[model samples]
Target chain A: MEIPTQKKIEMLETMLLSRKFSDSLVELCKIQGKIPGMMILSTGQEAVGSGVCAALEPGDVIITNHRSHNHLLSKGADPKELMAEIFCKKTGCNKGKSGTLHLAVPEVNAPCTTTVVGGTLPIAVGRAFAQQYREESAITVCFFGDGAANEGSFHEALNLAALWQLPVIFLCENNLYAGAQRYEEHTRVIDLAKRAGAYGMPGVIVDGNDVQAVYAAARDARQRALEGGGPTLIECKTYRCRGHGETDPQHYQPRDEIKQWQEKCPIPRLSDELVSSRVISSEELKGMESRAEKIVEDAIRFAEESPYPEPHEALEDVYV
Target chain B: MQKLGMGQAVNQALREEMHRDPNVFIAGEGVGVSIHVNPMFPTTGLLEEFGPGRVKDTPVSEAAIAGLAVGAAEAGLRPVVEIMFNPFFTLASDMIVNHAAKLRYLSGGKSSFPLVVRIKSGAGFGAGCQHSHNLEAWAAHCPGLKVVMPSTSADAKGMLKSAIRDDNPVIFIEHMGLYFAPMPVPEEEYLTPLGKADIKRQGSDLTVVTWSGMLGPAMSAAQKLSQEGIEAEIVDLRTLTPLDKETILSSVKKTGRLIVMHEATRTGGFAGEIAAVVMEEGFSYLKAPLRRVTGPDIPVPASPPLERFYIPGEEDLIKAAKEIV
Candidate 1:
């Protein structure tokens, strides 16, 4: 896949925005005592969200996991409403019902997020089945973590998608840790991509920190799905540079591993590649970073100013 | 009017709904070939009429079946999925209880989830504890789900049609014992609205509250009571979630005596719910103490004689009605 200069710059901007947005949430939790247990940041995994979501069209659907701020922003969710949603404000996307865990932005075609591991896999197949039944050209993208691969839903969803020849892309982000346990401790299969072949689908491994590689793999997978070739499983190997949650004690993750992954942070990596390749200058990269920082600041202000939902509002929306 | 079995009525409801809406489809294990051969099952002849795209035969994966149905319903399609038996519903409860039941509210009431899950319930076939447990109370306990259990063939066809057209997720439970029992059904289009109780027998001496498989035994007991000048009015609660408390109170007010009967075990059965409702709202009208007759708190036995004893029968209803009166 040939990368255009403008598209590369856009991808770079998205990755920076995701990093800034995620880091702001972490700061809010650590410094301001806001969103305590809800802060599950995807700071090091920005490239995966930016690359995969950029390849999707308007009508395509995305079913993501709990660590979903990057995917929601990359898929065109409004930052102000998303921030307000995390703050439990009435102006939030789901009217303060979902809070930070389950963010559903139907306008962006990202229907819902499930906090349960591997819960979105079978749903993605069903959404793809709907697309196929209607003869629509769009596909569904399902995102999960390394821990979800061991779930029974992973096997059942993959086999059903392949059996029905549905248009779905099962994108697994292997960050080497399922909450606190190491990935190796959870499953014997080191390379998660190999499991896709058992379901009669093509599985590809990509560098999750490299935006261009992730984009190329996602673009090809989307093309194959649209052409009626069934689903594809793309395993993006990455690292969680921070603890699983804001309140998580750092007693389990080794310090050396954290430093090593921080050195390969996706935002700075993308900036260096873009500058060295003459796609943009150092000043332009700095300008992009400042712009993203401003957006995050404005979102924070909007969330702080938003009103909390009334107590009586809780009784509503339980039924249609 | 024509005679139709409960299973055949269910099939007719599915066929008519599919013909009315193109987006309605059925998916389950052996829904295409295995179930179609029975001719009276709900999926019978659907594969032939709707083709393979709509009538999907899947692997024996209950979680996938239910999760996919939730996804499909979210994507603007009406999916009527099946969970083979009531006991197996536990395997798919995460999707049905966590996702499907909560999605609409999670979406802030912006999304309309239209899906129906047909679960076969009851123990008359002696399928043992795993396959024949009555768990309607479990489904009714959920806030977002609409639980419906129809007793007669006519009510089965009418309520099944209403459940499919409803915009909320419905847990439609059918008893295997009533599948082949023939009853009079109207040929013209009609529907039995959900959340309403039916007066199966209109007597005034006492009120026998029952539904689904227990309605048969209650009606038989009511017939025998009539010979002894003990009139028992039976209130068949068609839908359990959006319960028809108005009808129940009215029936109790008229009869002045109450007896709650169900096929499930006595502990934590839906009979407790009915008894509590009568105690709270209709206590002043009651002439005698309420009686509840239910299965013993034990797993359903597979042996024929033990199974017959395990299930609530007309004798139990008669004894309970006699005591309450």
Candidate 2:
């Protein structure tokens, strides 16, 4: 089922605005050095996080893969908390203990997010499993790259999820790479969704850069899971366009390939659709940009002023 | 009361806890996979009762399993994670030490991590170095972790029930050899609180303190020595972290001599820590310097004959006990 053209544009704009915010984080890494060991740039894969996160109710749980940040902000973690986390400030979501990699916000039910590949899948499955055991209607939405699908836990967890019909939406952002390695280099078959058939489940592949398409697919998958339709594998075909991590210079990717994907940037396309359909005037989109600029500006100040955690505090939060 | 092995005792404890508390859930590999290794005929039917949701079998992600348990506990679920191979505890130490142990304290005592990590440690059954490691001393070294090892079915049931109930992270280790060691455990609801030690055997001339699988050998040694008119008091330090210094020191005072025994190798073993405590606090009560009888400092050998040499036996305990007295 296709989402209406108008609603599609709105969702796509939200994705566009979020991508603008995260792109600022990347630029600030050069402007202010807020980046750390490995900054997982959301770059071209913004639609998956924005789309899946938009469809979820505030109380609904969402867990993201290592290539996160958009998932955090889209799910509504404090902008300051996310910025402070990337900057290693005590005011961050995990009190600076989680860093840019591992983060969580329990109040909104983003209890934890991990930097380890394929690590957050079982946790999302467990969170949903626990919610189901308690008879709550909250469905867990797990976001992972296509690379995570190749992990053994991916196979085991999805198989278990389908067998048990757990309330979870496995959102696969098929950005087509495991760091420097292309997705095709790892998996035996290119279409990752085809593998879901082995688990007796439906697999949907979509253009990840199309925010509304991603959103509609997420809403349908999550609804089915919450209503006991079991698990569905939705592969959002996207690109890593930039490097995998900040340290990932992406030398393996050819310049022409990067140029082509950059030309398909989701924000410009969405902004174009919004203006052409008269969903919003160009002035209105520009106003959203100015507002986002103010938010990011304030976020940067908060990150700069927040004090670093004491060395002793590093020894803390090991358990709770 | 029913006669049960250590494995059944643990299973019963888990069942009783889950039945009593809606928040309690047990997870790990092979827990629901026909209880792998044909480890027991008794725990075979538990999967049918609890189902995979509660008694989950994981995909060998030890770190993720422990970390997931931490998050679940934070979200208000009491998770008892079973680590299939005891030595694999090394993989989960980050969550266990950094997250589970320190989380409450770091959170200004606002949050409690009611997570119990169950591991079957120690060498036996020809499973050499990688599979076997007595982690009592290592776990004891951590401030936030509460370590427990039960040699008998009764203690296994009672202590596990206690560990599961305690509002803290606990590393409940089990010696593999004691899995089949049966004892009459209560069928009714019960719990043996942690930080309490039991005087397994009474004596006057010398005191022998031990735990885990060593409890058996130490007791046997004490019993065998009674014939020689050398009365030896045997105390089992069940909880390793909060060592029962009162029991250990009191026993050492009465006997005026102490001999510590452990399956872990001599240096840095749980016995060394106990010996140091006695030397520091119970020095005046000692008629002779404290002595330790432990496995030699070496990787656990696989050969039955060589393993017999590596692990401390009843003969070794008897000899050490006689020498100290």
Candidate 3:
């Protein structure tokens, strides 16, 4: 479960980059008249994405949900194309058809993203089924929010995945709130990981903000899957700092609770860890932040310069 | 040539296609282990031949089944999924319409979805409203889906091969009533291409355009009409989406009259689409207004007598053809 110093530093860099990218989107929405489509920011839950994705190989497939910018970036999706997608430009990953809610980069082995809650779980099971059938030593990862655990598809997908012993890691990023509804308010089971037991799969819980904790759990779960040990549900106990979307108001969440969670921000915590462990100096950590900010700025410029797709292009990709 | 039932023809097609392509596989609820030791009709001997890996038996989770098929298709497998009946297709519509149909387009052509969904449809055997509905119109309305319904054994085999080979998602509708119905099928390999209509019977008086279960009643009516010297041309529209407008227009132009028919309710059946096409393109050639012989807008009742009244029969088609002519 021990991650090398270089890998830990890369994980920190990815987490920082995701945070900067998410913050930039919020800023851009304020300046622009509107964010192209629905935008769900994964601001506070970077460790889960960075940790789980870092554990995966290039051939591994990951299915993501609406709050997918972090997952895509952690999985090595191009920031420029993703930004172009957010702007609905023709140069986007999905040719401007799928906005923020549905961005996919097949080049990174992340083939699909869905806005529907719990939608990607079954598809992930399917990808794993294909991998198992082909006898390929690749695993499939599915990322979803707390709300998705209540969906019937989650139960079905887990059952099938476990029954077939398919190579799949069901990563539940429990971000405490599902579109303003608190996790406990929606589901009686506070621990989403425990639900995996019903399907006879190992259920592990991790401190989602702690990068090493999330990374260790993900590494173990992925290893078990790749070793023909069936699926595992690893619930990362996390929180979302911002409102659900750009239009959502801050009426639902308590201000003090938000402050408490923000105080434990993953980027700063990981940065502090990296510095204290002597993995890197404080100046090096500062340099990574600036580099991440520069990447986000360049991506915004690329997206702004890209042209909108012609109206006729909408009719082109429906077939083939 | 061999005489085979529609179900046997379908089974033959699946076996041949699986043998032909390594990526092709079948999955559904009762596919791997039939209640009886003997294999079921359409999936006969599939488990024994391919083993449980390819002939997968799944839980009664239609949504997951559909999503699994879509994902597997995207990941380089040609998956043929079977929904026990057509009405159950409603459970999987989200996956079919949103994911399977839209994947290729949403990916900007980076992905190709080659998935086939087979569902048995139509009213017969007192299966009740839940299991007896023919909802091909719903699938045809979706832009990214191809809808196909084959009536004969040969067409059952041929169209399925074509559907499996198709690069897009195909909704393959099989008629429960026609599953055991015997028909002639060739032993040689063939494919009934998508977007093409077949002329079941050629005549010059009036064109009877129909598909699936309705083809039987229409043919019966066409036979009865022939006794009275009315030669009705029967045009079987095998594929609903990417519809065979050329054959429909040409037939209507030659016959100067058109009667569109389907087993589904008249409210929003694909007959309206065919009627509109003829009205728009072959308006001047039509000697009479386009007519539709379809089931009433009520659900298929469970009682035999009521069901008989509910389903459109040969008499209805004959009456409609006589009135139109």
RMSD of 3: 1.3
TM per model? Answer: 0.98, 0.83, 0.98
Q: Compared with the real two-chain complex, what DockQ does model 2 have? A: 0.15
lDDT of 1 by residue, A1-320 (tens): 59777768878888889888988887787766465246788989998989998888989999998999999999989999989889888888888888888888889988878888889998898899999999998999999999999999999999999999889999999999998999888889889999999999999999998888898999999999999999999999999887788778867899999999988888778788889988888898899999999999999999889988899999788877
DockQ of 3: 0.77
Over the stretch B57-116, how does candidate 3's per-residue lDDT look in tens digits?
999989989988988998989999999989999988888988888878888888888999
Q: What lDDT would candidate 3 get against the real structure?
A: 0.89
| Model 1: number of backbone collisions | 0
The CA lDDT at B130 in model 3 is 93
lDDT values, one for every candidate: 0.89, 0.78, 0.89
* TM-score for chain B of all predictions: 0.98, 0.97, 0.98
Per-residue accuracy of model 2 over B64-125 as CA lDDT, tens digit each: 67766776776678899888777788877666766676655533344577889998888877
Tens-digit lDDT track of model 1 for B1-325: 8888888999899999999999899999887877337766767788888899899999999989998899999998999999898999998888888888887887777776789999988988878999989999999898899999999999999999999999999999998888878888899999999999999989999998889999988988899999999999999998898999999999999999989888989988988998899999999999999998889999999999999999989998888788878
